[model samples]
Target chain A: MSGMSDKEDEKKSTKKDEAEIVEENGLVYVDYVGRTKEDGEIFDLTLEDVAKEEGIYNDEESYKPMLVAIGKNWLLPALEEELVGMEVGESKTVEVPPEDAAGPRDPDKIKLVSKRQLQKQGVSPRKGARVEVGRQKGIITNVLGRRVRVDFNSPLAGKTLVFDVTVKGIVSGEIDKINAVIKRRIPGLPEDKYDARIEGGTVFIELPKESRYIENVQYAEIGIARDTLKVIEEAEEVKIVITYERPEELKEEKETQEDEENEE
Target chain B: MSGMSDKEDEKKSTKKDEAEIVEENGLVYVDYVGRTKEDGEIFDLTLEDVAKEEGIYNDEESYKPMLVAIGKNWLLPALEEELVGMEVGESKTVEVPPEDAAGPRDPDKIKLVSKRQLQKQGVSPRKGARVEVGRQKGIITNVLGRRVRVDFNSPLAGKTLVFDVTVKGIVSGEIDKINAVIKRRIPGLPEDKYDARIEGGTVFIELPKESRYIENVQYAEIGIARDTLKVIEEAEEVKIVITYERPEELKEEKETQEDEENEE
Candidate 1:
């Protein structure tokens, strides 16, 4: 950044005047409120206050802007297309069709199973109750004598999705782009936990301390590296570092020393 | 750090000089290579090179020292007691009795279920094969006609457990103490992803970006804050912040400008 040529430096200053647009492969940060188009029942939100206002204030979940890599399947095709050519701070409401969203509801996904099957699994199936049938999850639509009807179609399927989105920022740079991929593979992590840097076309990421021992984080890390190489073509190697620190011992020693000095 | 008094400064210096000993509630870091006591087959290793040598090199998982807070039940009681009073860099081998490890094997845990039951769940059971039977996991020991014998006991239940333990470092500082609790709740994370700092008894933690979207992470964050207050005592408030960076937008503008200059 400090070694820019005079001509390049001049261009940097004026480039902001030219509108920056979202395009394929561009990473974008967005603040969005998502709802069902039919009823407008809030399904998701990236703002804390809004979540609070909606009576969905979850102390465990901290809400923030979501990062999306354009042209990636991270977002529905309809939503991604609507975001393109948008500028920072620009806001728009996009409606996504069921086909482009969760996909149209399939009647074939519904099945009827014997009540004994649910009972054997210790599930007392009642109408409108959510339960897992075999490997698929579904809602019990009806219960008749010995048979229970389960609908496996996604609840959002066949319904239009409405997203109120604001383009907060667009991402670029080798390090930031890699971070986007990491964020996609591992969502809901805070920003600072990521340590992404590129050296000599290689990317190094230090997984945050809280992620180890997770059931399949090892596989996820490998998946991230593979996906990063595919999307970020310049990344030749992806190295992950896990660091654990012990700072309490020093604090205890200091406390003990302070206690001794006070006695003296 | 900049505003400490002369007395505080003196205490800090002497703390490092005092002979450090492991104590109750003291956090310790250790590098360990665990193997089966009977056969000496490597089960776990914290060094990458060691893992590579043992033909267990996994590119996704980074090996590092493990942090343990004494009396926290993170490690087996037998292993935790062995670590107490041990100095940094001290190494020891601990053998845990079956009662203290995964617990003694229970013959009652073995059962015979009809092969039809497994087929109904789409599971093919064979002798010595691992399979899930009605939420309980077991190893098939025999297939007699239409019956499959399954053992539900833990794999290590009857085995004498062993651990090669080492004391790597001790933890200090208020933030680090809180971080250990967070790490316990969210394992597999690196140390830097934590942004815990205590100011006027209130603890502020900015959840790392990769952690926010994880299922039940919200509960984990809330649990961490509650546990921090219960353990740290002085922490009055726990505030979590989720931040997203758009460094790419600035970088993109600069790159576009650079491209324009090259064209000229």
Candidate 2:
């Protein structure tokens, strides 16, 4: 009986392994509906009707929904954890609490700033308007004489949010499109060696000579690149080429291209 | 005096337009420190404290920071609005409110499920441990008796997240990854007749049969071919040949290649 039980356990483990292998890099597409918990207001939806009305995508293509890997951080951490073992072609509704979803609101995050700062920054602090304070951005919770109260808290703070997500499809590929967006957030990467590409539904990036040996560079690049690529779903590769060409050199290259085109 | 005022307005508009252009597309790199608003906890940091870490990036290479575009949805709307018109290399401390950040928590989003459901699904529910429920993969909030409570809220909900973001660099290119990612997300795309290439940072995708007055069959072939070519980001040009060969004929070609390789 003990041997039989052990065999059963092995079978379960084998099945689990098979499941993981099948989902290793397959694409999963899904449609989702998100709503605010407090008022049950529909905040976001991947449905065609709502997406079309909201102009969610720049093109007029029908809403194709979002895609995510089961164990990947394609979504938020908590959300990704929940999606790790789901099978394709399956649909289910999920309910999340504040802690597991967006978490409870923090009161200390609310602050009042002088209107002079707004003026200095050439911004008008209006009621119910969102604003950026300091180097980070915040929303205007309220406005009073000469003072605007902004909450640096998340919009869904203290409110329950519901997501009706449908797994649509799944895919796997190398990393791509990392440094392009990362450079926009950070700064000062030499131009010559950093490159990114997407191929076979994967994102691939090559770092600059300066960053070739950094472990964190690889980690952060891979992490953010993977997440960003997952969000887009169709990206097979994103290549970012880092170099040290001056602005004038780039301008010259542009002119040369134009000259060639004219000749053609 | 009226003419002078008009001229001043024109200058301001031009300045704004230039700023918009700069903000619209560019590459940047930065160093950042992230904090949670709930209790002022430092959740993440890009700075490393060791010499070995510094060596990873070679010369003054730091961890690549998050990137954002002024008018793009890359950053939160509130945050992007604030970043507009800011000079490069400028440093500021920004605080984001929960509402504008992740938003408040909600109670209605929490759902209660039965232990029988867990048993049937072969999952063990533990207290304080987050678990996914249903096909949507909602996070589990709590386990009580026969019922498990779950939350679908965002983990960052209602928390003011702070970032010490820097503007690093600027770049311009076609939104190649975005299109590729979107295409990959949707299934059943034609695999022929499509060709894509990146030159001068712009991505050009060509559909052979759909070029102008091609027939549906031609279009189909082009679509299939293009889909195949889309996977190759380095190919300057792609040629697709559609042949009405049977499965046996294709097998014969493969066998011939194998025979040649074996002979070699």
* TM-score for each model: 0.43, 0.32
Q: Show model 2 residue runs off by greater than 4 Å.
A: A1-27, A53-63, A172-264, B1-264
The chain B TM-scores of all candidates, as shown, are 0.72, 0.49
Q: Please give, for residues B173-200, the per-residue lDDT of candidate 1 as tens digits.
A: 6677788778867875677887787777
What C-alpha lDDT values do all the predictions have?
Answer: 0.72, 0.51
Model 1 C-alpha RMSD vs. true structure (Å) is 18.2
Model 1 chain B is weakest, by summed lDDT over 10 consecutive residues, at B1-10
Interface RMSD of each: 12.6, 18.3
Query: Which residue window of length 10 is worst by lDDT in model 1 chain A?
Result: A1-10
**DockQ of candidate 2?**
0.01
Residue B228, candidate 1: Cα error in Å is: 35
